[model samples]
Target: MPKLWNETIAEHRRTVREATLETTAALVAEHGLASVTMSQIAKETGIGRATLYKYFPDVESILAAWHEGHVSAHLEHLTRIRDRAGTPGERLAAVLQAYADITHERPQHTEIAAVVHRGEHLAHAEQHLNALVRDLITDAAQAGDIRDDVAPAELASYCLHALGAAGSLPSKAAVHRLVAVTLAGLNLSPSTPDAAGGDD
Candidate 1:
């Protein structure tokens, strides 16, 4: 059809898809993932069943799309934080803290995770995350802020695994402490008593 008409139609479809994904996530969170249904999603999203089917084949596909969007948003958020004005060390610290907080704050939707976590998006996200942190580590190491003994990629992997513990941390304070410990491991010039004045 007309160009404007095509653009408008595309926008409308996006709106409908967004609404469906949001409604389905809420329903799954409130109820259980196993308990959610396409009919329920259609009703909650205020869209006809046929229209919902046009967007997603079933509840599983809808959840997968929602998860992919969620993961992409998270990656975008970290990119923004990394690009913000800061010294390499400062930006690295901020990124690590933000990542820890994200892990801590994410809801423990075990059922939904089991269904959606297996998608290729997870692998892509993991690669993106590793590269982002690896680049940050390289910058900070070059600046003499982070340790250079370990390879930046290896350090990035270590940070990812260490911070992953934040997901089960009891409180925000615990998460912060975990970040601090992780950062300490990366410190290039860890504090030590002056050899010339050990006892003053």
Candidate 2:
């Protein structure tokens, strides 16, 4: 009976966490990051304010949960792109493109991304992203696809900013414009453009 109670509690916690994330994302989509409230999310999730409080202490906590989900999804996509994408340059392009697509498709994620990025919590996530990007940058440099002189940390900062704001575009046409401009900073010399395409 004790084991069953524990299992039930665990499942309930999982449900609340998932529901909190969904509610936060929805509120972000409807009202933007600054407007979302823990009260609002509790109402949306059909749980009492006290129950919601038990699950997440504040609005930022909900946002943190939501951010965790987005980061996991983003990392999965990046890993797949890194492994299966063509060429080191193409991998970088694909990673950014995938990120751009996600922002456009999930405005809530974009909004939360913007809000979470306002402070040090996001800075930690940024460091993780930057390190991953640095690895890719090193590989690209080895293949002579990206400029060796540019530091990986610098490139990661630019890419993260771009990816975080990708939903700002008014239309698909703007995506190409933004991506083209961002890619231009990523080595893009005429000699490198024609390099054999394959990440392997």
Candidate 3:
């Protein structure tokens, strides 16, 4: 194929795939994961059943793509939220709060959040997010913003744990309290709140 023709075909393919993902996401949002299906996606996407098969071999493949896309977007959102505040403490809090809100309310993300927070896959995703979060933690510790007794690696592990815990919290008020307490304890500065500041 000519270069222009190939580019056009690729763009169209991307468009189709995105449409399928959006439709699948909407169904997942409204009906939950148990009822999502390739047939339903095909119908929602207004594409032929064969075409859906050509793009994704099965519902699992669609789900894999769906998860990958959600992960990419979530990481980007984390980076953006991290950038929203200047200081490491500020950025860390913002990042956790943003992720808490997302994973708390968004079903697709909440499901993947659970999956990504466990096992080897968690490490796999951490490979992409670790450096970004490490720098934030290191900066805070150096500035006496977070506690120094814990090494950066342990602190980083706790940060991931914090995001997971916040998502698991029952209420928004409760989640915020947890993040605040965790943030204070993570702060190396002695002036910060006592370890027991937030409700357990």
Candidate 4:
């Protein structure tokens, strides 16, 4: 086939795949995940069942692909936040806050969230996220902004585990407060006199 023809075919396939993923997700959200079917997806996506099968073998596979795309987008977003101009501590705080916001604002597809997190892609994305935060923590500790008593990797884990509560918080303000408390725990500065009971 000609090069232009090949490129055009690839783009068309990409468009079809995107449409299928979006339609599948919407169906799964509106009707429960267990209640969705490949036939329904094909009808809603406006693609033939054979074409849908060419992209995904089953509904579970389609959902997995959708989840993977969601996670990749999130990781990319966090990477952009981390790369923005700022001191190491400032960048770290920004990343943490952005992560908490993601947790708070993520779609409330309980079943999908539970199933998706169990996938290997999530594990890899988590490792990538951990490394990003660990590098920032190392920078901050070297600058005396965060305590150096613990390893940066350990501190990164602590930050992630602490901020995970944002997913269940009642409001965005609660999520921000949680981020503040998590960051406070990482601070290296001495406690204020008032916080120390004023020279008791």
- Model 3 CA deviation exceeding 4 Å by range: 1-11, 26-37, 108-123, 188-200
lDDT of 2 by residue, 54-145 (tens): 87788877787777777677777777877884777777776766666777666545666666667555566556767877787778777887
Steric clash pairs (candidate 1):
none
Candidate 2, superposed: residue stretches over 4 Å from native:
1-9, 28-40, 105-115, 118-120, 161-165, 189-200
Query: Which has the better TM-score: candidate 1, or candidate 2?
Result: 1
Shift in Å, residue 38, candidate 3? 3.1
Model 2 sits at a Cα RMSD from the real structure of 5.2
lDDT string, candidate 3, 62-172, tens digits: 656766777778888888888774667767667766766676665636553453345454466667677777778888778767777878777877876776776567888
Q: Return the lDDT, model 2, position 110.
A: 62
Whole-structure CA lDDT of model 3: 0.70
Clashes by residue pair, model 4: none
What TM-score, to 2 decimals, does candidate 3 have?
0.74
Count backbone clashes in candidate 1: 0
TM-score: which is higher, 2 or 3? 3
Quote each prediction's TM-score.
0.87, 0.70, 0.74, 0.87
Estimate every model's Cα lDDT from 0 to 1.
0.86, 0.71, 0.70, 0.84
